[model samples]
Target: MNASLPCVLFVDDEERILRSLRMLFRGRCEILTTTSGSEAAEWVRRRPVHVVVSDQRMPGMTGVEVLREVAAQSPATMRILLTGYADMDAVTASVNDGEIWRFIEKPWVARYLVDTVEHAARVAQHDFALAVARLAVPPPPVVGNAPIAARIAVLDNEGSLAAQVRDVLPAAVRVEHAFDLESTLELLADHDVAVVIARLSSTDGDVADALKQLKRLRPATLAIVVSSLRDSRLLIGLINEGQVFRFLLQPAPRELLRRGLAAALERHAHLRAQSDLLQRHAVDAPRQEPIATTTGRLLRAWRRLREAATLRSA
Candidate 1:
């Protein structure tokens, strides 16, 4: 209805189908219809399309191909795969590769289409904003005390909190003992830390991204953030995008830390379990770590990854 509202690109060679869908979604969204995938892609490149609904069986590029391109170029855009013909390989590939949020089958119901698009739009907006904010937010920096595996990584800055964590967590929790930036990275190479305990300070966007990148690399790890500054927006970014588990104010109570650690350990176990399941299924896509974990691993490991990534990028 609103011209300034978010755009949605619908691609299907079938004019009848396009017309029908347009009729259905005309008033609800700012719909742009195209008869071909290439046309859809062009539209997407030139304009900001919040969501893309493409027919899987397009003439030139299949729906997956179009959506995949959209994902690479404009990841903030929500992607949807629509088809009358459904197969496992195609579905899985679209899900894994294209990262489509929802799949709609043809002979689509008017109500379902509208509802699905609405939900996808909400997800897209929320996810993108959170991701942007996470650039400033830190992920939690602690996993758990699992004796089954050696403490490959330890994320404790040189502080009383670190000592406090050392006292409470499973003795197996490895300690990198990095007081500043440089030593933290040196420790990362030698060990595989499952948990990180970062002393949070107000830093730049790059810092938060560094934390998020580590979690992406090692989804099984935990990131716990201990901060004196409780910025709610930054905290939300950490929790939503950075995958931080727990939030503890500076000078956290020992009992609270103890309880949080226990929960974190449990979350770590669950992540491992789910990871094992995905591996068993032989899924190629990286499954996101659940947000329920207590905290992410510490700052040193988190920060070093960014430093390394920056060096590589440069």
Candidate 2:
């Protein structure tokens, strides 16, 4: 593909591996390499690198630690972990804690390595594109009884949901709550909340149906489905297919629930407010139906919208 390749920074303590990668991918991308993690971090701090591929077996800090730092600083930059099976725990931690997009074996083939890097570049570019989308289309408005609040419901056969709601959200929220999906949706339909905290039950209820209906009814509403099941397949399905905002494990501590819900709602409010702004901007935006192209049709749409926004701002 003739896509604009992303700037890549490859970090490893080994000079041979660095040289080999340089030989293979020198012309493929605007490549940057560092033999030390400290240098790599500094390079990242100084410039806007799109993607970082790092070896896990560094001398001082593991790949996970390095990427964690990267995630905190350059969140838009994609991360990848390269390692030769020294520790499975580190690899897993790298994937989870660092949010590393991909994990590759150390003795990778030149062709495979190239493909992996290319794929990561695509992902990094997508992340950047999504950031632009967020800029172009403002998030939805934040409307609620509480100035800063969350709409949380804990599904219980009894009124136990009240406890969950209280435990999760602060006093800033006016708890419009319920025990099941239907009641929750009724409250949600009437109220303006950034988040819906719900629980799953299989003894006599279909939790998936509840989640599906909520998403169908309110496309912009963010659902945080909680389940105590051994497997979170249903929650994952809702998130993947139904476009539910996020999911949480059931039996999570009340404090954890509070923090997670607060965060989810904060994001929800922010996205809504931004979306409303974008919608308002679109009123006089030099409108276009849609573009037909292979490369950057999506990005072009965003660029146009952002252009409109720029015009309005100016």
Candidate 3:
């Protein structure tokens, strides 16, 4: 195995599945395969593993539980969950507890799996660099004035969950509710929303789609998903595609919601400050030439006619 290559660990209860993954990722990365979730966790604890991909339905310890332990032990390592079943409870737990970066369904395409792992490795590298940079920089001075309150947008199909979110957030933070995706986009366009709480319905993919668009428009805005549906695939889509900041199960505790919101606001401030700093130091380019004035345009037109007549006569 190449010591320079990124180390990737694969965990599953089935031998054949592990064999297949080993073969698939053999040359691409330093692949470590294990059939026990507990063993996988132990390996991560001892090794400088860059990524861990585990099966969800392992015996003794489920994938979520194992990944959660891994997360606590190695927060910088990227975690991926692979599952045959779309158990919503387990999926939500994996996201909320394990903080997995991506979820891959069982019987995944070979190319897709390879691509996802490569992408995860790159992200892990970037995050590690950023962590080092943060440690090197001195903390900015604290402002004396009261901090600006973040504006939050809550989107729910029936408008009930929105009210619940609003109740938990502080009174100083402005909270806006939208019943559907279209309204949510409009609200985002009109306001500089800092956080989004989306309560998803089982039948509709609108909320997920809306969140994707929201990320494109306001990449710094933090997104929190609230859902009762136990579809692992849907949750995976939200995690991998939407890049949600947090996932909360339905009927969430008020305290939990409040804490999540507070953390999200802090993250938002950090991201916004970084963006502003980049803009401030960005180099200015030469401006485009101004458009022609009315008198200049007339002069140019007269010159063209005289030049045309001289050429025609010659």
Candidate 4:
């Protein structure tokens, strides 16, 4: 196995499932398979793995349990959950406790699985490179001496949702509500917004289109999508087209909302710092653009596939 190739570890109780995954990902990555969660955890501790995909329901230890351990053991390794069941408890645990990068269902399409893993690998590589770059340079000064209160925008038609978000956010953060895409754009232009939380489906305008425009206008601004839509295709579209920082299910718990907002603010600050550092060190520091990765292309393809499937069914 080439040490340079990205490593992926797949864990499942079923031997056949592990074998199938190994065959699917063979040659594309350095694949490691194990039946026991304990063994998989130990393996990750011993070696560097870029990603881990685990089944939710195992004999003694569950997938969430294994992933939680992996998260602590290898924080840089992206975790993914594979399950035949979509129990709410498992889903919540996967998000809250496991902090999984992606939740994939069982009987997954081969192409989709391959695309998702490839994308996860690219993201892992990019993040590792960024960490190395940060260490190579001295810390830059604070980006701007803006006000103490960081501005946040909630782009939702419902007043109640915005209110709930505002109530949960910290006192240091100021929240503004925008009922439509036009208003959201104006608000962003007028304020140094750190984060924008928007509904995935909005009556005002196309939410994905609005987010895309927002990114173009303010590359550093973080986007969070709140939606009840369970369609994988639409969610994938948001990931590829909107480049959302986080996804919050509709009627999100107050604690979840708070944590998501805090993380987004922290990310915004880090981005600003990086930008400032580049500008100071390099005379002509070019503006940064999101990487066009194979993952993104795959996501686009997945969206089209879903749409076609839906049309045929209709």
Cα RMSD (angstroms) for every candidate in the order listed? 17.6, 11.6, 13.4, 10.4
Per-model lDDT: 0.63, 0.60, 0.71, 0.71
lDDT of 1: 0.63
Candidate 3 lDDT tens digits, 3-71: 667888888999999899989988889888998888888998897777889899988999889889888
Candidate 2, residues 1-314, lDDT tens digits: the string is 23476789988988898898889887788889987787788888997778888998888877778888888888778777777854545643553357565566768877767876786676567667767787877555556433554555555656565577675566877666575544554455456555666666562354554455444444445566555653433432343234444444556567656666665566556555544322111111111222222136433433443354345346
Question: Which pairs, if any, clash in model 4?
Answer: none
Q: Write the per-residue lDDT of candidate 4 for residues 1-314, one digit (tens) a residue.
A: 87678999999999999999989999999999988999989998998888899999999789999999998997768888888987766765675567676677889889978987887776676665666676878576544323255888888887777898778866667889888655665566556788899876642235665565455446667788787766554544444444566777787778888788777787678766665321111111112222222245433533443354345336
Question: Could you tell which candidate, 2 or 3, scores higher by lDDT?
Answer: 3
- How many residue pairs clash per model? 32, 10, 1, 0
How far residue 196's Cα lies from its native spot in candidate 2, in Å, is 1.3
The residue pairs that clash in candidate 3, if any, are 88-230
Pick the winner on lDDT between candidates 1 and 3: 3
Candidate 1, residues 1-314: lDDT per residue as tens digits? 78546677889989998888888877777889998787787887887778899888878898889999998877778887878876545654564356565566778777867877876666555555555676796445435445445342334455677678778766665544566433544564445555666777764424444455556555566666676764654553453345565667778789877776666566566555444321111111212332223234544444555565456436
lDDT of 4: 0.71
Q: In model 1, where do residues sit more than 4 Å from their true spots?
A: 1-4, 126-314
- Positional deviation of 300 in candidate 2, in angstroms? 38
Q: Model 3: runs farther than 4 Å from truth?
A: 138-147, 157-159, 228-233, 273-314
